[model samples]
Target: MLRARPKGRPKATDVELVDVVVGAPDAGHVRVENLVMSVEPYMRGRMGGEATYAEPYPIGEPMLAPTVGRVTASADDTVPVGALVLHERGWREHALVPASECRIVAHDDLPPVVHLGLLGIPGMTAWIGAERIARIETGDVVFVSSAAGAVGSTVVQIAKLRGATVIASAGSREKAALARDLGADIAFDYHDGRVTDLLRDALAQVGASGLDVYFDNVGGDHLEAAIRVINDHARIALCGMISIYNAETPLPGPSNLIKLIWRRARMEGFLLRDHLDARGEFEAQMATWIRMGAIRPVHTEFAGGVAGAWDAFLGMLDGTATGKAVVPLGTLGAGTHGGNDSLDKEANR
Candidate 1:
């Protein structure tokens, strides 16, 4: 659990690993042996003990996260023993979860870890942002920030599938290359130069006058750049602001707000929890895309079981992770049914 509210960037010591006794579940609950767990950027905000879309983690309690596991013992017949499940009880090897809260996952054809990455929150988030929020259209020129990361990578492919010309930016050259491989018509490293300048060059290279859609994963400079180049009636989906997730104080907003008015553009921030009603629709679409080889899962797996969860979290926050940062606890293979050769190759790198 977190020792206290972090003063600046959170440190390893802030999260202590203490042994606790695990009791048998009640009538409606089951004991899950976690197989794979996720570490995402939003989790940083939860540790701040501030009011947000999700409740903050308690000062000295187990940190909750997206986890895929199997039921070792179940009090409810609906959720049988050895059944694979998805729940939010990560940061620990085992947890007592309500059977009602457990979503039984079918992993016979796919890897169980896919429930924590490509077919889970990240994939759904991308679908919501690209299709619903941004309303990507054929021939539209789209810009995606953090295009090598989990949600951004998915957004890139989705926008491309919609027949949009995709431009992307990443923190490193290697990540930028991955973004291009993911179907970005133009991909550049944000560190190469000023973001606004790079974006302008990318747009010119693609012969696009301005952006029709912008999927923002990094805020601050990236948001400012997007606002500067948006076409009339453009839509921007604010998925995350990873650039400022660790900031100790509030950062300034985009300086180009007036451009939104001039361009008649819309910028909206969305949380995944608010869009749960569309999960079934999103899952069906993404599953088909995965089967057709139109979408590829991207993730980095840490291999120390429960002990590696913290490292995975830190790696994700520090931009060392390419897509989703996952930690494997039990012996669940992270492969995606032997389909994603590119994903397998990237993982080896």
Candidate 2:
């Protein structure tokens, strides 16, 4: 099942558990005991044998991702024992990583996964895309696609925090309701009918003069709709394109791109890593907002055994999972109770 490059059906087939030797930190490396690593849509693109925004996962090498782990050993003085660090430890159980490559996650009132979700890369993407790029302002109208997912949920909250009237689109009625609970001014089901018609109704009801900001998470039709509804000088933040990630062939471009010229709308694409220098300021501000109940990180926890992890990932891509899709990597016999592990107990202190 292992492949040097992806062939047919991009999946997590190259899974293995090899005994990894932890060498002494070589000046810049740190040894970590990983707890949880996220399986996101971007990982699927890396396995598809295509040039992407990020590096492709190499064959016969450990798959890399942001993992929340404890620093068991350190080669750098800046990172010490028991320090909860976020690093690209890949699929393995542990890793030796460069000190500068990881962030020192101080265990505060937040859980380890928050370092991956809220305070993590996804959180930054949602925040910066909405706050800085979208420039969400009070009384502005904002629309977010994939509004029930991780980054989408964050975008909904961030837009609300800035006083923007928010509208969100989800794949199901259930997700739409959840999006409403997360402070979205309006939530529509993308599966109901023509998303364009639903968007028009939402704008008419809200009395919006086009949209001030469009936080696009899904591309293709969603992008086309946002372009048509954007007001002059509206800002569009291109976050991700989950719709086209798995297409066997390249999909068509937006047919309504001409609207950009007419509306004078600005559409810009950016990876979260580009704004690393400003992350500290953003994180600190978000932490204070979180403490004040101004923001929330909505997540869905899948409890199936390790064997069901792949199914969970696919479920997320298919738009079947609500909120932030997460499969908890817990021991099978860890607890007798059956339910989502308390988010309050594990995440928020």
Candidate 3:
């Protein structure tokens, strides 16, 4: 649990590991042994003890996040023992949760971790932004910021699959290369020079006059730059602002707000919780894409179970992890499930 609201950039001392008792579930609940949990950038906001899209994590209480596990004991017959389930009580080894909060993962062939990454909130956010909000079309020139991260990587692939030319930006050369490998037409490191200059050069290289769609994961400089070169009636989807997630004080807005009026462009911010109606469709389409090798899920896994989740979260915010950062707690045998074996091999190298 968080010691208190962070004063500035959060530190390891803000959270501590304490022993707790796990009691058996009541009539409509089950006891889950968590197998894997997701660590994402948005979680940083929750720790600030301020209201946002989601409720703030109370001080001195266990943090919650999307988790995948198996039901070890169940009081509800509908959710049988040993059934794989997805819930939102992570940062712990065992969670006693209502059966209604558990979503059974029907696909037995895929790795349990998949439920916390590509097929989870991150992937769904990308899908909704690209397909519904941005409405990316063939021939459209799209710009995706933080293009090597979890949501941005998925947005890059979805734009390419829709026949849009993609311009990707990342923090480092290695991550930039990753964006290109994932099918971006041009990928650049944001640390190279001014973001505006880099974006202009990328657009010129692709022979695009201006951006048709912008998927923003990193705000601040990236948002300002995208606004500077937007085409007439362009669309921008505000997925996240990882660049300022750890700021101590309020940051300045983009200086180009007037450009939206001049360009007749539309920019909208979204939350995945509001779009739950589309989850079934998104999951089905993504599953097909995965099986056909049209889309790949990218993530970095930490091995020390629940205790490692904090480090994984910190690493993600510090830009140390390439894609999604995940913590696996249980032993799910290899080759029995569908995970990215090629990425594992590359990590070993």
1 versus 2: better lDDT goes to: 1
Q: Summarize candidate 1's per-residue lDDT along 256-321 as a digit string, tens digits.
A: 899999999999999888889998888888888888999998998876766667777888888998
Q: What is the per-residue lDDT of model 3 for residues 1-82, given as tens digits with 9 covering 90 to 100? A: 7787776678889897654656678999998887888888888899987788888898988999899988988999889999
lDDT of 2 by residue, 149-249 (tens): 88998999988888989999988888899889999988999988788889998898888868888999999888888888889889999999988876777
Against the hidden reference, what TM-scores do the models get?
0.93, 0.87, 0.93
lDDT of each: 0.86, 0.76, 0.87
Best by lDDT: 3
The residue pairs in collision within model 1 are none
lDDT of candidate 2 vs native? Answer: 0.76
Ten consecutive residues with minimal summed lDDT in candidate 1?
A: 336-345
What's the residue-level lDDT of 42 in candidate 2? 85
Candidate number with the higher lDDT (1 or 3) = 3
In TM-score terms, candidate 3 sits at 0.93
Candidate 2: Cα lDDT at 150: 87
